[model samples]
Target: MPQSINCRVGCPESEAPNTETRAWSESRKMEAMPSRCLFLLFLSTCKLSPEVVAEVQESSDGPGAQEPMRLTDVQAAMEFIAAAEVAVIGFFQDSEVPAVSLIHSVVQNFQDVSFGISTASEVLAHYNITGNTISLFRLVDNKQLDLKGEDFESMDATKLSRFIESNNLRLVTEYNAITAIGLFNSMIPIHLLLIMNKASSEFEENLHRFQEAAKLFPGRILFILVDSGVKQNEKAISFFKLKMAELPALAIYQTLDDKWDTLPITEVLVEQVQNFCDGFLKGKGLRQNNEAKEKTSKVEL
Candidate 1:
């Protein structure tokens, strides 16, 4: 005989697990089942499919958007994490009677939800939820964040490094000379350009736009961002003959041709950058070795 469970919203309809319920006998005693398997069980028991489950979130103005349902399985959790940039997840502790703790977590990926799990949902489906209840809550409204350093939700430059690493761009630092050299010597022969300071809003926006434009060339062109104000990058600055007085400058170096073209990026704009890169690639406009001069600018970081 199989056990019956209540339907959505504690509806009167009761459903049985039927013939497939035997496999879940031990899982029922396990307390916390693997989210992926649990999801499959949920779909089977409810007579639902992925397409039906996916329609739960119809619109941003819909009821589900205001109050997201508790994440019951891996698929729903992954979808929730992808839709919400910020979220609050509830997990049980290791005590005899597990107590739930609601913690705020930034969405890194589907696998790295609130708790310390790093495996993707597919991988996590093979293992149990580690002997505790875990649930994800969506974040739709504005909420105040704890800015104190101790709070896990706070993010710094080190945390932001993971986001940058995901991108194919090489982050050039003082000690990255060798790495830069290796990139310059790649099979495709990289055309290296440096965006001196990315902290400025204008520069960051322009750099993002430039990166979008450069995506068409793929493995051919590469851009490195360097904050030359750091004391350790003195060698890189000196090697490139860069003037600290003009910190926010764009320098393009091609070791293959032994050519260096520098320009002071006083104005950060997409059209201007596209034109410059286009001209450079077409061999139309390049500052002479002596022509790329340094100048003072008011765009402070």
Candidate 2:
């Protein structure tokens, strides 16, 4: 038997988890901070299956818009999270709980994240969530976060929002409208953007190797993936002065002072990526300044 969750008015829901991501394990380390979000990933829209594409389209079209989507069963939850870039799922047995209401309020403010709720007995047990919990899932690292326990219902709106924002990051967060909010709000001030063209033959190899490199620095740096072929991502690519010819590339950006460094690499071995990250951390990166605010304005979407 699973623990029962009770929810009242003004509570929230969460998103599903993709079963495809079995390579990683659970992480429970807690660190607190706030700053701007930065990281990018490029993925081909064509790579998504027809149903997955449809789910993304429906979400973009605002099918549930302001309200959290209801997860009737475990399969529904799985599909929802599998297709989302960032998702939160609330596993609760009661709709009258205060924490649920609080999360619901936060959901309305963060339009970029997908929120879903599951009261199903199997759904709660599947995630191993005892009591009422908010599980945040991110595609970047295939990581699932349990926001907190015991005192979750007592968290105020501001604290709840900040907690979600700061932890919103993952190992290799993708660049997009919804994800951009989390990327910029993260407390990590420095960013490493892996700009790639998914259509290129080299994309998969680089992605896998770079992910291992990203795992090396958790709180110290933000790793992002950006695809040059994605039209909407052109803003980030061009802002970094990355052209298709110059990618797949890796660039580091410091948000506090708006400085950046870009490097085009032919080989993406873990060691090379690790060296890149190490160089920037050791103050060896040739970071330059540009009109970042004016140029990145379009990323607010």
Candidate 3:
């Protein structure tokens, strides 16, 4: 016995066919077709050209240029500094290297800015007493102000005391000679202050880790990481020495902590250490393998 299946030439078996039903079935067949095939069918049906569709596609995916950052206005700068918590002061010294000072700062007037530090702050003394002509800047929101012809003067004791009271900053009790004062005629955007503080905090944490590593490895390893936030010359050098002394290993100094993994130690020095370690490990492995082979041979004999 055999079974036979039959299909009508122009009708679907699922439903009864009429003019509307046949038209709907034809539309569904066309919709189910591949896009390229449908496009060809559409062009054949409408007698339209392919260039129009190609133009539309190009317009949707075209490349565009990004807008540049606009330079901030004075009012924007004032508002930024008024709300800032930390600032870096850049100054030039007798040495070729520029000095950077990080301190708690405040903005007074639109044109006048002030920073407070103990009179004993070596950085302040160097600029004020040493007659160091330094350029000061403030950064916020990736905006920077390059302050030219900046000057620093001692704040009156009464004003200093008032500033301390207003800002709730601690007065140095032990150093009566140290006076706190504000810096005026400076330039820096306020938003950058916050960014600098965040960066400095991260740098300090990485620096602490580097110091710990140095202590563990001693003379066998040396680490060098620089802290850009460290503005005081003596303090920066002292910190460097303290970290180096922890390990009798080679000297390690860091210029800036670039998130810890990639240190900016001299490239040549880093290569040397890596090569040495690799060779030492290889040699040790070879010796172990040789000893194991000797034992096996004796057992076989």
Candidate 4:
């Protein structure tokens, strides 16, 4: 957490956020660098990596619109999933089923989420799926979230969209009502959180560095962004004992142990973030463990 920005740097205390804590959206706040916030918006347009060599699921409508791809072989399925951080595969008995059409519609709606259709019995049995299912694969933590049973039967575009929103865990998941559930319920033990106001000017720089650092940990840690400026996010900031005054900061939360540590940061750099994560892994960043454990009960919810 930051103490105060120097007036010589153009940020004055009078202009800082008050107790009410309205998000600082003014240009003055941007001039002072406290580090930046995370970008991957938790909901931005997720772009597929152009460098991916595997053939992605072609959208049913065609590659012109980038619609869902039809997949039959298990090997092709694996390649489609491997091409992106998050992908959704629809396993149906056949393409004529009503659910398949509904899935195609829903797939078109979420451009950022990858989608594929598989009707082969071999593919279905490979995943132990007996019937129609929509599987969301998040390679970041190797978490496979599924939508099936009654929900899959009555699914519509709106319902399918909600499923993606709630379970779409990207490289750096942002903190919000939707993602909060996914994060807490995640089996991943340690969470690397970035607390900064998205409205801040340095948000892009900080987010880029955070993403780079995330690449180093993969399934080991889940990186989360908690925006200090959003009123709705005050609970998250407070959950980590952070004040909006401290616009940009990073913290590590160990869900298994209910402990956390705040990384003292003057600027958000890939190397610095990497060091913080490495230290935590080596069991060196638990100085505030005792203090943060008390709040673990609330976090458990």
Candidate 5:
């Protein structure tokens, strides 16, 4: 007959392994039991079906995983602009509809994004009355970023003047009420255009030097020479036209203004053009390489 057995509720019976064996066995069992309990807990907590988990695991860990493609510099900016195209420019109107307009815009001068719309548009009225809020989305291939910001009713004239000077933007006329009001109410994008005057041989030579430097790093230079003089000689105009035609890549130009306009050729425009050109070159190189690779692959296949 078997010996009478007495085991406490939490204690293992005598058939359990002896001393060291029992401890090891108990430890292993404890480990296994917890794992099993945890697995059950995981199953219960997950909302995903077993099939979905299996599919994801197979895709992520198996041969199906693929590296994501990166966007080239130009492509990234273009993608951003394309995505932001339909962005709303919101303006407050006391009248019937709180006016909102969708405008097409471009990211000009690298640093500031610009949009071209008529100054006399309804948006101007709204902006004049109660300021404005603009919202847009930026996307580069798979990446996305949203932009939302407000426009001030009036920017300081002195500040604007400084900005104009810094950016090389030549104002058509001197600081006047009309110009001030136009700037105050205008929703001109942050970008400014630089117009350089090529009145002298020295100026032309400097322009050429700048162009050469830019070519050393293509897509890294922008020079627009505007001939703004009362007695503009045909030789000078012809020379400018020829130069512009020759150096199509370099942003060279002559101004058409009879009165000397300084605002058109601001430093801000110069900086922006430089940055844009650099990005453009980089993007172009990437695209060309990609094309070459595709061609090679096709030939091999």
Candidate 6:
């Protein structure tokens, strides 16, 4: 949190309610720096790399417009604003000229998004009839800008910090057999496995399955995907004694008990994948036969 922007009594402030704050669109308050300077400011405050800045600057003006959803009225805008931690508001300078700035303000009742205009109530005031459109950018926790004040000019490098510090990501990274052994060592106790050729459809299907699973389980289970076609994978293939033809197979690795199981499903559909995952949780789907194990085993990486 930063010092509130002092403005008209009803002005929108960033963050908490009752904080005396002004609108970022208050041109009198937010001094316009050169494009290069503003670019550098974004680099420092937003923790953007030089390459990203260069890429942004390379664009003629800016990226193509994908207009954000606009709030309908004051009631809707107030509701939208109240729910957000941080929001960016876009305002039109005239009929065509548009500009935006970040704000942390508690608001209530509007349409699809929270909105504010320079007015009497100091709350969401509908400007739709006036042809003034505003867009909101909801900035959540994690890598985010934490400036010292509501004024954009006040942002300094020292104030920027990461909200979350732990490495909780669950995406499956590319790996070979040797690297796989070292990788999963630190993973959470329970993990699922998907073995498929990187160039094949099975790889994509499995990837989607794991990513979707993340929405529900989050860090509870790890999804590791391995490319079974590579030379590095051959060692794992031999370790599991899998034949050449059975390339794509699914398995689950339980680190707590040091066990692995071959999933029963031959096809990688969403429902079947979920059921296989459920069965693995129950400790039911282990390799049943030596012949079946030899065909399905593609040691997880």
Best by lDDT: 4
Model 6 misplaced stretches (Cα beyond 4 Å) = 1-170, 177-182, 201-206, 264-266, 287-301
Give Cα distance to truth, residue 175, candidate 3, Å. Answer: 29
lDDT string for model 5 (1-301, tens) is 0111111211122122222222212322332232121000000112444543443343334532221112123323233223221111222332222222222111112122222222223533322322332222111111111112221222233322322222221112111212222121112211111223455445555454444443333211223233433122223222222222222222222111111101112223334445554554344222221133343221110
**lDDT accuracy of residue 107 in candidate 4:** 65
C-alpha lDDT score of every prediction, in listed order: 0.35, 0.61, 0.24, 0.63, 0.25, 0.37
lDDT, residue 199, model 3: 46
Instruction: Write down the lDDT that model 6 would get.
Output: 0.37
Q: Candidate 1, residues 1-301: lDDT per residue as tens digits?
A: 0111111211101121121222112212221221111111111123345542443433233433333234455655444444432333332323232122122222222221222222244323422333233222212111111112222233333332232222112222212322232232223333445545546657666666555555444444445555554454455444445566665666655434434555666655556655666666776644433443443323333
Among these predicted structures, which one has the highest TM-score? 4
Model 4: pairs clashing at backbone N, Cα or C within 3 Å:
37-203, 57-69, 58-68, 58-69, 59-67, 59-68, 60-68
Question: At residue 92, what lDDT does model 4 achieve?
Answer: 91
Model 2 alpha-carbon drift over 4 Å, by segment: 1-168, 291-301
lDDT of 6 by residue, 1-301 (tens): 1111222111111211110132111211122211111111010123444543333233212331122224344543333333332332333333233222222121221122223332223232342222223333222211111121243233222211111101112245444322232233222455565667778756666678666764444335556665666665554444334455655666665554445565434556667667777787787755422345555334444
Q: Candidate 1: TM-score?
A: 0.37
Residue ranges of candidate 4 with Cα displaced over 4 Å: 1-66, 287-301
Instruction: Write one digit per residue (lDDT tens) for candidate 4, span 93-201.
Output: 8678787777767766666677888999988877777878888776776655566777677777776776676567788998765555455545566788888878878
lDDT agreement of model 2 with the native: 0.61
Instruction: Write one digit per residue (lDDT tens) for candidate 2, span 1-301.
Output: 1122222212221211111221001000011122112233322222446664465446445655466777877767777776776677777878777767777788766666777888888888787877777777765544465655644666677766755564465567776544454555445667788888888887888888888887777566778887677776665666566557677788887766556777787768888878877887777855454454344322122
lDDT of 3 by residue, 1-301 (tens): 0011111211121222222222212322332222111000000012223543332233223321011111133332223223322222333333332222212122221112333222223543433423333222222111122222331233233322233222221110010111101110011100000001214435445344434433333223223332233342123222222232222122221111100111123122334445433443243222221133343221110
Deviation from native of the Cα of residue 7 in model 5, angstroms:
80
Order the numbered candidates by lDDT, best leading.
4, 2, 6, 1, 5, 3
- For candidate 5, give the lDDT: 0.25
RMSD of each: 19.9, 12.7, 33.8, 13.9, 32.7, 18.4
